[model samples]
Target: MIPHIHRRTFGTGSRPVLAIHCSLAHSGAWRGVGAALSDIATLHAYDLPNHGKSGDWDGQGVMHDTATDMALAVLDEIGPVDVIGHSFGATVALRLAIEHPMRICSTILFEPVYFAPLMADDPGFAGGYRHDTAAYDQALEAGDTAAAAKAFNSTWGDTAAWDTLPEASRTYMAERIHFVRDSAPFLMNDSADLLAPGRFAQATGPVLLMRGETSPWAEDLNGAIARRLPNVQEVSLPDLGHMAPITHPDRVATHVRSFWAAQGQGLRSARL
Candidate 1:
């Protein structure tokens, strides 16, 4: 059964667009970017299960699958639309484009955390990533949810320190830290079968893959994804990190607008 996802619409344009936020964030994270794109496209953003106002996960099926299903339900309701996602959300966007190409007009992926490709192709980086994140893993194993959340956030979160965050924010993260573990099967192991041969090549539409130049693993991971895509444009934002979409939405939206415009021009030329 498709879970009831909580969503909020941004922008006032007729062209529809879907924006998926990264893990540990809610639909509101897209406010800045969505507002920036409001002139040309209406952006619809949703909170994943157990995040924001959405209901809790029943712990029944693969968490990633459940999240993807929630997004799919929204897509079906909104019809074919350009989709944008960040981090884990970007993985969902990629899957939707690859598996339901007919339903996606174009796609923008902001630092998708599809680690399987890198793990298989570059074991050195994979090892380094695991080594860097071992503390978070250890905390999870020890059943230290708060410590796990702090460790995870220290690495992937914004430049702010964990202790600097508001107490409520810290509490929120601690409650959902288990999602990091629940997401491992798909993000780390390719449980969704997204890497199966010929699957990525199936998304023939124009794709814009954006990453922050400062992000440690984004270049490598996005590079891996770019190699498999038939049509893709890569952009590296200066001085930004993995959380750029949330931290610097206006900057990200500038590139988004440019990419969307370029695609529009190409479509017009093709029709001509």
Candidate 2:
């Protein structure tokens, strides 16, 4: 059984929307971005099992189980939705779509952190991640939150533009990264090829798989997955990297808005 989960929702309209946070981050990442998308429809963002306001899942750290609980929780909390995910959250979004085909209208993934092949291309990538996690955990246990935060920022927690963030944003992340360091990798569901075969290869809804042009690796795998999906759209943002939503929210919003517009009234008229 899963524990209770909490989410933040925005907007109020016919189309329901949800955003799942990447590791080392929380639903707050989508605050400004969600505001932009909310006008078109409703938006909801999750805090993950141990992140944000959600209760910890204890031993259920595996990605599949976490994704399952989250998928059920989101639909139960805000009804069915169209999901958008970034990084590890995107991987969970993909899993949720596969596990519960009936809950999603459409899916958008921005650089899901699918390891395996991606990590293999760069030896020690996953190992480095594990090393960072351990180091941060040690730092936290030693009561050196600054050192822990610095260790995280040195790897995945800190961003090039993070110091410029507002005080509130900084505070929010400071409180959230503890859960991120604890929960993200466990919810990654990394397989030999990243995602499951029939899951990504034979998806049932519209999937917008995207990557940044300057992104160092993993585009090949994401592209390959996109090609296999029945109704998938592939996109690349040359100027963007891992932080597409933050680096180019306007562009991402445009691409999504256009996708939604093109579908028009025909968009998921019949529920999956």
Task: Name the candidate that leads on TM-score.
Answer: 1
State residue 159's C-alpha deviation in candidate 2, in Å.
Answer: 3.7
After TM-score superposition, the amount by which residue 137's alpha carbon in candidate 1 deviates from its true location, in angstroms, is 0.9
User: How many pairs of residues collide in model 2?
Assistant: 1
Per-candidate TM-score against the hidden true structure? 0.95, 0.76
Per-residue alpha-carbon lDDT of candidate 1 for residues 1-272, written as tens digits (9 for 90 to 100): 65679999999987788888888888999999888888888989999989999877789878988888898888879877889999989998998889888778889999999998888788788678879999999998999989999998988996689999999988888999998788889889999787888988899888999999988788999999898899999999989999999889899999988998888745423422
Best by lDDT: 1
Scored against the true structure, residue 212 in model 2 reaches a CA lDDT of 80
RMSD of candidate 2 to the truth, in angstroms, is 4.0
Model 1 TM-score, 2 decimals: 0.95
Worst 10 residues of 2 by lDDT: 186-195
